[model samples]
Target: MSRTLSVLFILVCYVIQGQSQQVDQDSIKNLRLNILPVVFYTPETGLGYGALGLSTFRLKGEELSTRPSSVQLGITFTSKKQFLMFMPYEFYLDEEKWRFKGELGYYKYFYNFYGVGMDSREEDKELYTADFPRFRLAAYREIFQDFSIGLGYEFDGYHVLEPEPDGLLDTSLDIIGKEGGTISNIGFLALYDTRDNIFHPTKGWYVEGAFYHSARWLGSNYSYQKIELDTRYYQQIKGNVILATNLFLGTRSNGTPFQDLNYLGTKRTRGFDNRRYLDKNEVSLATELRFPLYKRLKGAVFGATGTVIPSLDQTFKASYKGAVGGGLRYIVNKKEGTRLRVDYGISGDGGQFYFTINEAF
Candidate 1:
């Protein structure tokens, strides 16, 4: 459940001092800051509170860059005793020709599991606690106008904090990496991005395809391979109205660990539990219609459908699950078109409220 609710109150004094002033592409600049206090409640994590601060600026004082680079830091604690601290950052250099992006986080939290496949029943739900530190780092070089190729490495170390005695994970003898181990993978990335701004886009397309391989030489506890393709399209339908769509497909092979396999939930299947359905392959599609409601306010209607399969060979044989919802958006940074979003999505199982910064895509 990646839900979050943020209430943003701009520091008016700073805005009046010219922080909101528009500067030409060739002018000197100061960094822009966006900060918000978060408060939200979910059944899984109980009441969570946190703050996120984002700083955006040009690199090497180059104001004509395609987009401003940004660094975001956040921390949160839930009433259920879950704690998380994270930093995500993106940097553009050499006149936006080179890019670096990644995230690092440490978490002590509880997660639920429903056995190992799409057919796993809700009645089989069980909970356990774990502590982990995860990190990913990537660098890309632009090879064309809006296309780039890159390489990235990721590390995830999981340590069981409260083992559930006789639970599925504790009883399953075939599940490798279950007792807590390190997973390290290095991969290649290819991307094509044409969005006017990374935070919000009225018209553009963003596509990425990548593959990663874990090997013994890389100090990984298990060896496996994974591949994914994600594409998103945005278009302005009329005055202040935009339509957005996304398609995502992913699969893993070569003795991939249970935790590393593709799963359906979270960002891809909003109404379901995070990773509620697990398997080696998954496919999902989502669409949303967004339009202005009033000054600084927006409304959206969205729907999504997805499914998980044990293997690529069984792709279409599985049943598809769906979710639909509506949301309200409050423009936080009109200059950059960033917004705070609140959505309520429902599936056959039930509904869940989601709050977050920017669009889900």
Candidate 2:
């Protein structure tokens, strides 16, 4: 896995280096492809390597489409033997009346567990290995202007490959479905979106809500229900400056597995480690200030506060954690506002650097 990722990284560098001299203005079209190499270092995963490719297109050409449909493929491998491969796609059909979006992935993750609640400490790190193949599909049809309703199906199979010795998995918490299980659920989705550009929205709002349930009849190892709400707003403060904000909330019923629970990290808590905190319920509120620097270059400052609790009944306590960071962006595809992002996120635990495509939101 490491060798393959290394080779992929090298190939992407070679291709990008040669792209500038071969640029052709007359060949410009609705189809755009962006590729980049990913490299990061973390204590848990050691040196990680990967590659990501994003393809965006529109049937009616970029001028007529409100937002270009996209497909993303990404993979990563670490010295710890952790592996991940994901392919996600979004499509618009029939003049934007119908929409399809989902993802399929395989993962062998060396996940760290620090118990199951907000009070869990960093010293409680327990390394566990889990292998899984997951997929979800959602299709929506527009019912009103800027509003859509849809249905989705999801399947996740989790197998515990290794459990930490004398660690939280067996000693501290008796988490549901710890031994491995399958979750099969059907969900309902509703979305309201008015973003001018999906890649880099200047002024608009996007809101989504979803409800899902898993039952014995659905081949689920356990029965549970989940609800998620995500809303984002963007405003052009001035020329070449935009303000973006996001609010996200998620909750699940009892008997939910740890994997299904919400965590503060990665996309939500940029400064913290991915999945650093876990619980049945979570809330995150964040904002980013984006502005241009030099030509084809941009910068953003972002900060977020979030927390996870075992139940929705918990008061919005002050135990909330926070992460703040700034990032640099280089416009990879100026026509579509596609960018390559490099960020350094810092929290009380420490800091982590990220490299990838597209905005954090």
Candidate 3:
């Protein structure tokens, strides 16, 4: 537990983005601008982080479905860590409101550490730098009442980081040979989400399924030939309460491809280091419970478990391992439709506590 605390991470408050045009009757459409600012702390890294994000929407008169499209831009910075992100995305809604077409225009992520390799002997220590440009184009269709199915092609990857000097541990990663590679998966997907609405804080169930082929590219896990299945569920207990869950099952002919692209920090599991469980085959599960404490303020509790096996050839079962904890979520702005979520949870293995955004799914 001391080691976890020693990492010096700060609690992070997640703020969602942007708005719709609320204007008088206009020409073909109305344009609106939406922006969001976020601040967070990492108790493990003793780091402070901030983000500014914006979105532009085109509305067709008062039809709501007349002009269905939006563009987004965002940037992130940190005080303790040097990592940053610049993202731009575009989305489109069909005239019938039955489908959503979208694409992430650009995604640029830069990762940096304060004291990585000071070893004078290792020349590669200086080469420690990672960044990537990624994008995805997806379309969602209303399969049932509020349920939906989605399909798309995605390309995400890591900018190459240089090898560490011999005998020196690269703070950038675990395996010494990892150079941070690019991964692209062209596939199909299906999803179902019913959360009252996409803009405000209402809860329901959300499930997703995706399949892709790496075609021997950076996206290929061990050596291409990969498939992944992901599912999620969110429920509102009475009215002000919520419960969330996540499940993932994936494998590649050689292994899985998307696991290695995690270049930033621990996103899901608290007890284990980020990307610690990447293997030929992987399975993971997580859950969370939340309730509203007061106007603009909410609290939550969560837990998680996951593991990786060497191959699909061998049948491996999950041991249901993870963490548990709780935190507060403040509805920072009603007009902005933004919420600042700060959650803390501990892992089952060592009961390590962690705090972060959303529901950890």
Please provide, for model 2 over 1-361, each residue's C-alpha lDDT reduced to its tens digit, 9 standing for 90 to 100: 1211222322122114213222243532366677777776555677788888887766543344456678888899989888999988888877788889999899998877777777888887777888999898999999999999999988899865567877678664568877789989899999999998888899999999999999578789988999999999999999989999999999999989888889987675787776788999898898999999999889999999998987777746538888899998888777678778777777786766667778888
Ranking of candidates on lDDT, top first:
2, 1, 3
The positional error of residue 133 in candidate 2, measured at the CA in angstroms, is 1.0
TM-scores for every candidate against the unseen true structure: 0.89, 0.89, 0.68
TM-score of 1: 0.89
List ranges where model 1 is wrong by over 4 Å.
1-29, 42-46
Residues forming the 10-long window of minimal summed lDDT in candidate 1 = 9-18
Angstrom error at residue 260, model 3: 3.5
Q: On residues 179-272, what C-alpha lDDT tens digit does candidate 3 reach at each position?
A: 5566666667777655543433346666666666664554433345556666766677787777777777766554333334221125455554
Model 1 Cα shift for residue 188 (angstroms):
0.6
Q: What 10-residue stretch in candidate 3 is worst by lDDT?
A: 116-125
lDDT agreement of model 3 with the native: 0.50
